[model samples]
Target chain A: MTAPAGQRGRGRPRDPRTDQAILAAALELFTEHGHAGTSIEQIARRAGVGKLTVYRRWGSKDELIAAAVESARGEIPSPGIGDLDGMSYAQISQVIAEALPGSARTLAEPGYRAMLAQVFGSSVTHPGLMAAFWNDHILPRRRTAHLALSRAVDEGVLPPETDIEALIDMTVGAVVYRLLRPEPPDADELLAYLRSVYEQAGMIPRR
Target chain B: MTAPAGQRGRGRPRDPRTDQAILAAALELFTEHGHAGTSIEQIARRAGVGKLTVYRRWGSKDELIAAAVESARGEIPSPGIGDLDGMSYAQISQVIAEALPGSARTLAEPGYRAMLAQVFGSSVTHPGLMAAFWNDHILPRRRTAHLALSRAVDEGVLPPETDIEALIDMTVGAVVYRLLRPEPPDADELLAYLRSVYEQAGMIPRR
Candidate 1:
């Protein structure tokens, strides 16, 4: 289905930079105006590209918005479990201390917060999008963390019968609840709170 | 600045029934269309009242919407701490089993879920609304739960140094995360998970 050589030469090939520009514009506008309020035309104009180009690249506004959200999330660091085997309580405490603050910082980003709100709100009406997000973004991260926690449990770092799924829920849920607050706690305060959680769970020895 | 007796009689006192009708209509509309999508006229028409009456009563759509949300929440039974004093592991387990399910049920309602989505999404743009909700609804509930947890700690039902606030966050956040999922666990499964959490924390002894 390649175009004739002459036709291909007359029209310049699609520029890779256009994709980045469109995604950037889409993210900004989506955060500012929300999904319903934003239009493809505005995204194109903001990106300094033609509407047809946007349509050609992404068939619908929903597709473009999804890509923008994915782009905004970027890369989530996969926490490794190699050093977790037979880790001492102090070592486990250090791991929690280092991990939680990074999570808090990422969730505290204004754009990410806005995007999450939109995703959750829209999920009710659009279960498909929610499914996709869970499959693509949430499930992978949970799997990685689950593996690490399982290793920790196997090595007796956590209690033998530890409910890893619920533990993950509590840890992740607490961070999310803080982000949803009108004035989320500062990173230092959040880190202190995480420390308190670790201490209560007996992951860190009392002073 | 009382109105003259004659003027008051001519105007006829505002009907209390109208208030009920408006609230009912508002809750239905807000749940179906969300805050941004719903309008005063639709609510007035649905309630069989004049637009002027709706405006005069509520002053603004946001006020009306807030009232609707409040009414929908009905009453949340404050989990009492009196019986918690000297409570056994089995008794504490029973209390959690009763409490968490009720909270989960309220959160699982379609109307309530819609309202939560709207609140979370709009909170980014409307911090004032978020603050008011926090002050009026969230703060009171948290305070009640906080009091109960503090009492539990004092009674030795929970560890002496338990981070009561973080515990609350973890409990509430887990239920919320479950609700947000595409296919949340059933009541029995959720209760089992919650029991596991309590057991792992040594709040309840293992069977």
Candidate 2:
């Protein structure tokens, strides 16, 4: 209920570009210092904005983190027709080949580790953080794998009684567990072998 | 080595009590602040010891952190059953129920998550941390589960044709994935259901 007209205050207006910039900076901060260690002042400084601007835009550090992570998604390769699901398990080995090089580098980066620590660690203490990390990252990737498996199941490549949930968890979870290893098994080779097992268990002829 | 050893160079000799106090302080600090956030000054202050005293004894923060964790290694549980050849799946489920509460909580802790991030993340870069983490933590816990499954197979409780590793992994791995959730399921209930599914797969009998 503003009686005064044209009372808006600002220089160059509120650019969504600036918001995106701030979010990007926040992601960088989280990746560097983690959620607990990061501060609004750092995000603002990195974004070339004022601390007041950060506080005004996002009420708390948690909100800022959510916004930052929400952007910069689509970086992860979704499990779809491309290399993961489109081809037969044997053919899908190529996708793993493509990913390993980057996986090696990305996992090595301190920023990446810090980011993972911030998310996986804080998830237990903060439900909101857990929701953000899962919905934003895990669900999309999980859906991709789920779709691939669903296709495999529909094709009768898996036994009608195949434990779909178990099958998915074994392959995916094992990969994550192995990611903690120095020398992980080749994803494609493992996938190729796993698919063979899946087919054999289902009584399907393996190529 | 003919030296003037008149008074051993300083005021109070190194007290075992002080050493224990320092270690305890380090543990409390590490648990509260995580590995990366904790510092030597904080540890010394918490212990009510001089900074020089702590530095002289522990040497480095990493060394101190390692000592603090190693001291608590005795607390991690293990299924004491030497062989499970005669035990039913209920026996196996019982073992999990007894051991999993602490296991779940350990994996859920922020400090442990920080440690995990350091190991897993550095594994891509340093390679040594991976071997250490596996040899120290993951492999040992995993061995108990593996031994139980293998024994079940040997005793004819489980089908001989079972992919023992895969089956065991899939079952426990799913539970672990669920355990990492903010609102974790009841460990007993989950283990019971997993055993039932194993029975359906003929890995274990219905009874």
Best by DockQ: 1
Compose the digit string of candidate 2's lDDT tens values, residues B1-207: 122233223456778899889988887776555566788889999999877787777656766766765554555565654654466666775675556566555555555544444444334434553565456555665666666667677777655766666555455445444544456545455555455444434444445
CAPRI band for model 1: acceptable
Q: After superposition, how far is residue B141 of candidate 1 from its true place, in Å?
A: 4.1
Model 2, A104-190: lDDT tens per residue? 454444455455545654554444765776677666655555555565566765445556555555554444454444555454545
Model-by-model lDDT, in order? 0.67, 0.58
RMSD vs true structure, all candidates: 5.7, 7.4
Model 1, stretches more than 4 Å misplaced?
A: A1-14, A75-96, A135-137, A194-207, B1-13, B75-93, B100-102, B132-141, B185-207
Error of 2 at A37 (Å): 1.8
True contacts kept of 2: 0.26
Candidate 1's TM-score reads: 0.79
DockQ for model 1 equals: 0.45
Residues B1-207 of candidate 1: C-alpha lDDT, one tens digit per residue? 122222223244778899889989997886676667779899999999987778767767788887876776554444455656565545655665567667556665666666666666666776555566566556655655565566667678676767887777776666566666687555566667656665554444555
Best-matching candidate per TM-score: 1
Each candidate's clash count:
0, 0
